[model samples]
Target chain A: MQRRFGDQEVDICIVGAGAAGGVLARDLARAGLKVVVLEAGPFWDPQQDFASDELSMQKLGWQETVLVAGNNPLKMGHNNTGRGVGGGTVHFTGVFLRFHESDFRVYSQDGVADDWPISYADLAPYYDRIEREIAVSGPKHFPWGPFAGPYPYPEREPLSANAVVFRQGCEKLGIKSAVTPLAILSAPFDGRPPCINRGFCNQGCLPNAKFSTLIQHIPQAIAAGAEVLPDCTVTQVEVDEKSRRVTGVIFVHDGTEYRQPAKIVILANFVVQMPRLLLNSATPAFPDGLANSSGMVGKGIMPHSSYDVYAKFPEEIRLYKGTPVLATTQDFYETDHTRGFVRGYTLHAHGARPVAMATGISVGAGTWGPQLRRAMLDFNFYARITQVGEVLPSEKNTVTLADEKDDNGLPLPLVTFGYGDNDLKLIDHAVAKMKEILTAAGGKPEFVIPDTAHLMGGCRMGADPRTSVVDQWGRTHDHPNLYLAGAPIFVTGGGVNPTETVMALAARTADHLIQQARRGL
Target chain B: MATKSHYPHYNVLDAAEDWDPHTRKIVEARLLPLESVEHLTTAETKTLYSVVAALIDDDRSEILDYVVKHFDDTLGKRIGESQRKTGVPPQADLIRRTLSGLGKTARDNYGKPFPELTVDEQHTILGQLERGQIPADGIWMNLPQKEAFTKLLSLTVEAYYSHPKIWSEIGHGGPAYPRGYVRTGPGLVDPWEAQREE
Candidate 1:
């Protein structure tokens, strides 16, 4: 039975309604455990809230004040984070990719980042299960990665002009490229329709063609008896000092503070918020923070080095005519010491809307007035390719508390990040390769825009308690009843999108939690 | 002088009738008249209008008015970027201070208010502001000039490009909803999409 907002204890209390939290809610609720999900943002009905206008659709992003510091101060808005129940999944491009087998044992393979406690074999089944369940559409034979060929759904048809030019370039260079694996449905499944090439996937999908936890897992979780409470900002995770276990979370809804007790607590929020919550929940027993035995609660955060290279072609390439990212090449995804970088990157033919194109040129190239207007005038003649370069973990890159406090009376999170030498070299190589590809396709490579995306790591998972915050199953080192899920626990961010890996890890954690509950642990 | 468009024949509003009702309603709202200025002072509003016009290189009053009003609305609602550079003030504070500081710079250097300055002079000051070469005294003390200028320019560009008139000028297809693209081959265009004249 669902417990009321009081002292009543439930089986589990999950503190976020994003991808990992949604998966945990559905899995655990279906197993007959009472669950309650606390989301800081509203529960949006897509048809009512979603719009095609870029300015208005930006409300889907997390808009709170987070102080950023470092040489490369990260721009934080619609690109990196999200608001509402679905979190970043609501507005993310549906490029679903699994990390390579070598990604799990990076230290052993390349001697850079620490190796994950678990391997690709442990999470392989979960990845397969998620891909089939989500109806990922892709080509029959993926040219790279450990698992190749025969995805659950066939590749999407009628490639966009941007994707066609990308493929032509790769073909001219004798390089392999294929249709990107996407979470967007290509065929009708479970009452949802296929994609219609609306080109507004970044602005919340209105037709239910793209997959989001908001439209998919949360609904299933609700059906399985999980109570989802939206617009509740969790202030702190209350812990019992004597027992050394987390009791529940204290959240504020409509200016009223309420504490809902639970037997187990899960911090499934994003990288910044997860660390902020832990650091703020410091008690007499744990002065540094809860789950800070190794003092790794807010350390080693990584953001993928995503930079765009724009090229001009004689023929018009109306980039906004189809899905944003359709074709990709992982030819440089593996580490090649010969390239002067440790790990490599994945290049995708990315589509750009009018506003994004204009702003990117303005910020990236520092063009204004006549120069900017001239560039926008030739918007149709431009095709863009972006790189997802892997960034190594640095302990200096961290999330710490700021002097300022948010409306909820908690100190604001100050995130610090900077690209290491290897990361910069990787970017330079990818940019040159992208220029080569565009030149080979009979286009003039015009602008190279530097940017970043996909935030991962902070509460890194590892085997040793002294060096890591969480175990392989997402159980924190200090507390038995407390768990951390999602991208926050990523040991080493791979040179690909991190959403698939996040959900797979969450599924594995849910399985462990269910088995433990059955054993009455 | 008017802003010249590469695709002079294209008009994105022609397909507005085909969009979903909700999306159409939101897009059409951008064309509405300015209700009121809720955040900026009268002086700040005037200076901002001049700054946006100079930065975008367009002097049409309607677009400028909408841009200023949208900036004000954003400030009034306190909606801003998720994060900021450490040591930088909040956007509202920075914008307010920068507008006043720009006026001070104009009066001190050009012997005129920001709106009364020549287009070339205005461009020169903007360039200096972007490079953080603006003197740090009075209203500009402890202020990060480049960061403030970038934020203002980004907000202005966003507002200006989001307009349907600008969309047509750039040959953007506006919002495609229930009627999505059918012909998406390389360099292919659907009948409803924008077509550039030779």
Candidate 2:
């Protein structure tokens, strides 16, 4: 029951209809281009949004990051993909942020951080368009990263309890703070309802207040004339050597193999598996990978630096019942030469959802009877704050194909990453800030948790083939049409949720691809 | 046994060293996340309502909206504990380790947090509850306690088995939320009505 690519040849064959792929497909198809998207996941069911259930353990939850197996024996297994048509967008906690201007030109400013192939100005408008299209909310007047514009989305959601505390803490500490720009609807606009205050957005939002691709871009693309084939995993790509162009893509459906030819092939599989598809695309002309001639394939992968902090409170405050995150402090976002860390982290703290908070208390508190319940009841009041720091990309921290094979027999990725002193020292500074907030919040006994969750530096972007994988527009130097999105293309991880920047990059890539297509090679 | 939201972290070892060998058997087991709603006893079900009531009273909704907009999944010390419990040192596996998954759902679904709990302790706790042995002490899961562990046989275990609604709720749908189930103690029963096995 394998379905071959529809009889007609499409202008572009895009693999991985996840976040970036799905967005790009809609844009390309709407421009009167016959585009075929081969998604590994099927149409996701909102009814199946079960991350909130008591029965739904983390094991059952869809993964946010790829779990690199093998080499790292101590780490858990599963280099995961957000399975289903919407890919990771369906489950991602909708935090949108543009890499600040300093982020776009880190190497130029401090000479410490790496440089990107393009400047923030080149991608700023795309960021604006994506936010406007997706209805991102933040202050229009405030300076963000390196760019600023009219409020693309109306600011509406009230600051969470922890955000309130974070504000107070910042005020006390005299640090600049503001509500972060986000994809979530604050008050309600664009005919969509406002957030209903359901604390389970990450588990999946049925209300559609959260701007998942399924609710926003994909729907528009469909209305404008685009066909999406779900549960379709593209296994390989075929390129014509003589033409030096992608002939089409070869995929499988229902255990049967099929091929679809197109004038252009777009690999929109984010960073992790995007390379896998290209690497697997073996032909006489390009033996190493579809676009891996520069030998920079799968090099310079950058995940954001993860920031974390935990604190206890005396009152029964019920921290878990509210929105998980709301406001952010950008005081440390740029080239603050005074600081020891190369790149500063963004400060963010908000209410903890009751479910997750209770779980936190239980880790230390006794489990079983009265003690566990009391810990839950007691923790109803405790608060915690954290930050996301941008880490500079070093060649050493990277993701490579491992010797171990997955269930698919494809070599799984083995990631080698560790925090340099710069990151650790920044974390210590961030923790000190966290401690001050906890103390000011009247948390009688506040303590810093430990070091964890700083993601950055891999598959970096730059103009030079020697140092970078993709150009500023995210196009790979080796493959003209293929583009990489998500955190992987980041030359230097910016201190914030990279989703918004990712949206901007994807939008920018779409526009450039159309321009190239019109030129007709 | 309290449900998973009762503890904030779950799933997979971060480092080879974090696991306490004794808790391995307990950690691997998957208990159902739910108790069918209709099966709940009157008091245990009431407890669930009370927790929700308290949450609503605290304006949990307003707070959640804020944090959702600033979401970043990062696990700190809990990851260290995860690695240390298994006696494995931290390595690259650390970055990929997610403490968010390990939250209370695992505890609620399985009724045990530590993976290495001895078989004897497991049986002792289960057998006492099944035999309706209400200890003289209050409850271990409840707060402000002295002889809390002594009351383990009487309150939390009974509520877990008797209240099918709490069990079902934890076993299905969303990640197990915290305080959805009620605590057991004085508000629940009189001494004479207690199912103590003399």
Candidate 3:
């Protein structure tokens, strides 16, 4: 019953069917290039596979063995990332905000992290194209766009009570707030239905209203002659011994190994696995790892540090009645050194599920038994505002190969992480601001949920070959045909969700490859 | 008779999806649908039962008996499986060692094993373990006593909440599938959810 792919050759081979890989596959296939998308996890139909269950969602992440080390331990195989063909997009809350212009010129503006090789202007057209393709809903005049482009779809109406409360708090604090732009459909577009406000966005959106890569790009790629082989784990990206060009990829499918040759190879397996795969593919020609001559493959790993301030009101708020994160206050998004942090964060209304809240309370809410019972009774009366803060890239926080091996006999990725001093200051300031805003809205501070969101950096992109892994076009400096397509190419992670930017970067890279092919490179 | 409810309009189990495989599997796991105890030794089962009885409410002897088996199976699989040396001992060894240490402490102090001790005596020993105030020469000296206590407490809490009876008491809308929430906006509750007690 197992399908097999032999030593076949293709014009393009993308190693992850994620947000990036899906987009890249679609673009390349549409451009008349033969594309093969090799996904480690199976492609699941939303209606057939997804359900609003906590335990099932718990098992959705990469369950293969991974080691957590360093001062701040990473919660691997958790909600951190997904393993399905759609990748993390399948389970995301659909908050798709564009990176600000300053996000690219971080080194120049803040004198902190290295500046990205490409600016927001370079990515704006792709962002617009993707927004239209994904049918993103936002305000009539979206105020947050650094380039300030109009949204293709109308804004989702009737903001959830949780979002309203957050807006009220922002108004009380005299801070700027707006409806968060989301990739979730607001109106029926391109034959897909609009969001029904089911509230279980993280459970993979069974209604298919959310614009995950599963629903958006992967199908288009398949339709346009791309071969998407799901449940195929790429073990190594084989390179020509003399030319140092990526020749093909070796993969395992259903316990059988196969080599699929490629004219161009793209690695888009998110952050951790992308670096891990490259490191595992180290040949005698390039011992440090493929495309790792800069020694920057698994360095500067940044997981966005986040904090939440929950509040309890007298009236029934029913926080989990709509989309999880529908609105936010980005007044503190820009940098201000007076706050003792180089960069800032955005505070968004977080509509958490009852079970998620219960788990949060059970873990560290400082209440137990009878007291916990009282809190659970008033579950609908709770609302939270979470700070998605920016984290500076540091070489110390890295993803290295662990000595322990997984089920496939591959070395487990050891994620070593610790909060930088600036990151701590940023968190402290955000918490204080959130507490103040909540108090002004006549709400009592209940508890704080400290965690990280959206992993980024590692194989960062820059103009300088010495300090970076890939060029502005996501082509690895060491190899002509090898490319990276996800957040791993980010120079500095912004104070918001990075999926939209990741998609934009992927589109840009795909365009570059297509243009190069047209010029007969 | 069925328990009188504050939220009389809502069916607490309306969210439980029988049609969806993922939700159904989760429901089965949460319910701990087991025919018999497969993993726990007789003594280990007795100790866990005693601990659960002390930590959670005592009204349900039926639920605790079943819940302990799930705990036992989970602990058996997880113990010594951790790749990282996270300062805590393996979960299986942690349970066994902690139980033995508690008994030793009880016998040395009150001339009885933990199960036979009075509620106050049990509380005293547990409180010391929780606070990491156990003496350096105590039986739990080698272990991260506070962390072990927390780990056990968390497990007990998880097991306690997994049942439907506890969910009803806590006013939870059990599952949300098949009939997914239509009223997900602010101040709106679906017919199946708990009504506000006015």
Candidate 4:
């Protein structure tokens, strides 16, 4: 069940095993290159891991090791990321959508943002490759977005009855809706089972149907003879000023120190950790940080303009009986000036079971005992209306090294951000629409819980080396051989799941990384 | 009780459909429906018992009682009013048995947060429930307070997963838009990872 590598050096060093890091590690390793991935977490096995009991999940650090940093406070402020070998991709919702062509050029189009160095056309093929490699499910022909290749209809997990009804509501509004493109295995494909829709995905899939890098990419990396060190935490990327390069990475495992030297380094540690890691690795040449030439490694933070709406319907319907997340409405995916919000909002929809529903609506207190026992019966009749809006880029919304240190004596990353007035306006707008839909379905507000998902930013992408940490290829301006991957490089939070885009970008960089490695960069 | 209520899915469930607006695919353990849930899940169950034991060790009886009393919950006010109306509250022993099963964990039987944001918002939510703000698709439980433990628990362990972080000693994390960022603040060594060697 375990493999050993005493002192192995490699062609590439992948810092994290999340979406981008995992995929890149697998691809490069398959190319017969010696790859080493240092993950600062545990590796969960499907057979021996993934418990369904709620109590276990709570105690097991929610199956995530990306422990509490100073940045996110209040509520479930941080979307849980797997600290284990698979990383965030293990816990992702598998909703894969291409970045709208305009998404790459929001600044040019809307005069509100900076453009990604790569265009939609340039990254289109990588998207297709990832779609096929990961087995994405969706219509090949998307009428809304422009991209190459035919839609690979991978799998469609069972749609809950309520999801169908919600589709009707979207149609009634005449919004452009499509079968969500997802990484969830719809049928038995690539040695994985089909999704049976137990809707406990966030807890980790018992069935191999969900597309986690741990299942898909990491295994491939191993088969290609790559060294994946799970439970290994990379602390700093040691800089060599004489060579103007990253000579090695210093980390701790058990109680030992490890120095992983590599020709090429990829800072794929996600948006949050990317900046912190880089900032934590301060040197004489880069006293500010590793790639602090711009002082922008932790700037331009944007949490998905995340918000939610809930309506209590008149039915004992079980929402948690279906997929953890089914259909997401990206009807307003592209930015429209009319909406008052610069980046538009993507509507994510779902229902819940009695316990889950009670969790949401049970935010209030009532008489305990018999009085409480009769409280409205099973909270079966409710739906959760949620939206992910684009939070505008602001240097003020940044992730910095907090004064407090972790157990490792490293400064804990502090995420400082607040919803601005514009965000408030957008939430108000989103709430109105959500209310209308809920009321139309004959539901009324028991309450609304506003929260954000995919907490992004702290690291952003741009063309200006002085203003941005990474270029369009996700290469750090300061460290040419090093690349930054994950949602942190996201310049702006798109109105949809950023996983697909992250994969596409990683794939594109994988090709470039191969070229550079071949050239002996 | 139902008004111009359009459809249950859109209003309460936030239903999302990929192919059509009327159907959904619920993926499970790949077994045919009923047979699937029948399979004994040793992993989650074993882990659950351990967590329960730990919770009980923490001596948090209040939380256990809350989840037990509120389990199999019908969020509307019908259950409460019915219990009060029946006038015969259930025995204390039943509560003890149920609480013993849950072990100890914080239960937000009381309104948590947004309670302090505004009094009006708090009262409005409670008022709606008491004054029949119940949604149409909802099932009403008419149980005598103490005796009609029609269903003992409404939710599974997963239902309470979001509780400890939101309403307890643990806090939320990450940078971006954190709902509740844990400020282990400056100068304090994070005891959570204290075991991790430097």
Model 3's DockQ score: 0.31
Q: Which pairs clash (backbone N, Cα, C closer than 3 Å) in model 1?
A: none
User: Candidates ranked by DockQ, best first?
Assistant: 1, 3, 2, 4
Error of 4 at A370 (Å): 10
| Model 1, runs deviating above 4 Å | A1-6, B1-3
Better of 1 and 3 by TM-score: 1
User: What's the residue-level lDDT of B97 in candidate 1?
Assistant: 94
List the candidate 2 regions with Cα displacement exceeding 4 Å: A1-7, A47-51, A54-81, A147-150, A282-287, A354-377, A444-458, B1-198
Top candidate (DockQ): 1
What is the lDDT for A40 in model 2? Answer: 67
What local distance difference test score does each model get?
Answer: 0.90, 0.53, 0.78, 0.57
Determine the iRMS, in angstroms, of model 1: 2.5
Query: DockQ for model 1?
Result: 0.63
TM values, all candidates: 0.98, 0.70, 0.90, 0.71
**Residue-wise C-alpha lDDT for candidate 4, range A399-425, written one tens digit per residue:** 677665655788766566666666677
lDDT of 1 by residue, A380-460 (tens): 889999999899999999999999988777899999999999999999999999999999988898888899998999999
The stretch of ten residues in a row with the least summed lDDT in candidate 1 chain A is A1-10
Docking class of 3: acceptable
**Best candidate according to lDDT:** 1
In terms of TM-score, which candidate is stronger, 3 or 4?
3
For candidate 4, lDDT tens digit of each residue in B2-121?
221122212111211221111112111111222111222333233223233232222133343333222322222121211111122232323333332222111222233321323344
Which residue runs of candidate 3 sit more than 4 Å off their true CA positions? Answer: A1-5, A145-149, B1-10, B14-33, B49-167, B182-186
Q: Which of candidates 3 and 4 is the stronger one according to DockQ?
A: 3
Residue-wise C-alpha lDDT for candidate 2, range A45-134, written one tens digit per residue: 564433342222232222322334222211221112355666666656666777777776777887875777777788777877787777
